[model samples]
Target: MLSHIDPNNQPTMVDISEKSDSQRQAVAQTLIQLPLALKPYLQGEELILKKGPVIQTAIIAGTMAVKKTSDLIPFCHQIPIESCKFVIEIDSTLKVMITCEVKTSYKTGVEMEALCGASVAALTIYDMCKAVSPQITISQTKLLTKTGGKTNFKRVPQPLYGLVLTGGKSKRMQQDKALLKYYDQPHAKHIFDLLSNYCEYVYLSARREQWCNTELASLPTLVDHDDDLGPLGGILTALETHPEACWLIMACDLAYVNAGTIEKLLENYHDEVVATCYQNPEHGFPEPLCALYTPQALKQFQRAKTAKIYCPVKVLQMSNCYFITPGLAQEIANINTPDEYHQVRHEHH
Candidate 1:
């Protein structure tokens, strides 16, 4: 089932007439191995040759190739390229690494353009250095990443950590809300297990005192460092502890947030924005709990916290957040008070 093949097995271009235009980007890399004879020409980081700046010439050729990618590739669409950038470096091992990044705003992706750009840049490098040695070889031309297609893909994804916020004071519930058992286990453990299914690591974001119990002490915990900030404090603690990690933050009292709801949230996630969350169907606000937060979002939260903005919902509202409506609005509801807890507990379980 080739996308560029017709029913009769004839080659054809994909019909993107009905597709909506979006910002698309792709990155590709190519490796070129040079001979030891070229080492004398490699001064510092630049390769100086009578061919007039080998790297610069290759960059120009790569940029041109990126623009004319459609002319070379049979099925590629003629996309108006927004930008093409190249980074070429030569190592002590006489190996040159060329990276090509291509950007466009079009219906189809620019993966082919990026691949062409890198391949052509490697070829140009080989052409310039072949006079020095016939042993120059090009290898490993591949796409590294792509965005704005049906799905975004990355060769090396950032570490995704999960946090179950259980640091709430729970005054309204007349009990520790996280300790309430909606399922067979405690609420916090249920959410922790659910998040564990998807994330690389899962932790219970709890207050230090909450860990006094043997049961709570046994679970992996990230104790709240900031005091009296509710769920915001737990989130900040998790982010501060692992600055490089992206988070899937969930509250303990979100009784209806099952595995399926988390899957939907993850399916809509993209790292370009600060966060990805659900649009609260009742109030038209972004649901901060049960959301995915990246490092970019964490930095903004830190700035907002310094400015005395503690509401997670408000921070999400002001930031660049991708919001999607849940299949069922009730799946995003959290039990904040005794009445709410009792009602949901009786109705659901």
Candidate 2:
């Protein structure tokens, strides 16, 4: 049946009053081909022009478009959007991909809202960058995925990897804690196993000298590219190696961490945040070692590195990070000293 056509052959809005309210979501994407000359101006995640920051302005414009979708599109029902998220990425080819995801609990789907948001965002990018080069082009705009209603659908999940941080000096532990046996296997291996259950690829973050472990030799490893920076260097190395995939980072000393905690982290994951981390019960700050870092977080870390700031926790604290308290406080317990390690080992055994 035609949704916008009445018996009189006039465009009409479909009556959705009889339809039951259900949670609905839609994701739409658009690509903007940026000029090569303008690529260098994109410092970190956004470019600043006379109007303002390019990506940030586009995000605000997209959100406004999502809310005004019905007003712009004839016969489209106005939806009270529960949430709107935008992910903007610029690739090596100077192509910008803008994705807008909209969610609502309404009778009709939000495909129009998502599409409108993406289209407006692309246009805003073009307007902001046009002074630099008019060669910019809005290549494509289409709905990537949607959910709810009778026909629920989804695209494949984004490529997400895992990084197990084992690059620390272990000075407090008085030994290489990563090689310490926790469950008849190396501590690094145990954490690797936990991350492997959720990620398609899992890598051990280690120093060059620590690569001698026979068990870790067979698995993928991201050796630290820089020295003296500790876990911050390892995280930057992982981000440099895999710039596209989000990294789920876990420290080797987290002896009490289990698959449940990892699952909860994934379930509550927020893509828009720089990083999603568990709040340290003792410190009341984000636990950086066991967290999800998106590309934005990586960019922020790189900026911090250039400024001689080497603390990952400080970076998360300063950026747009999401922190949640774990269901079990012990899930974030890190076994730093030999006594603590021994106690945790004995308790588990």
Q: lDDT of all the models against the reference?
A: 0.86, 0.87
Model 2 pairs whose backbones collide:
none
Q: Which 10-residue span in candidate 2 carries the lowest summed lDDT?
A: 152-161
lDDT of 2 by residue, 93-160 (tens): 67787989999999999999999999999999989999989899896687767899999765432688
RMSD in Å for model 2? 8.6
Candidate 1 per-residue lDDT over residues 45-162, each given as its tens digit: 8899998789999999999999999999888899999989999977677778888999989899999999999999999998999999989889878778899979987653269899
**TM-score between candidate 2 and the true structure:** 0.61
Residue-level error in angstroms, candidate 1, position 176 = 0.8
Give the TM-score of each candidate.
0.59, 0.61
Candidate 1 similarity to native, TM-score: 0.59
> Quick one: best TM-score, which candidate?
2
Stretches of candidate 2 exceeding 4 Å from the true structure: 1-157
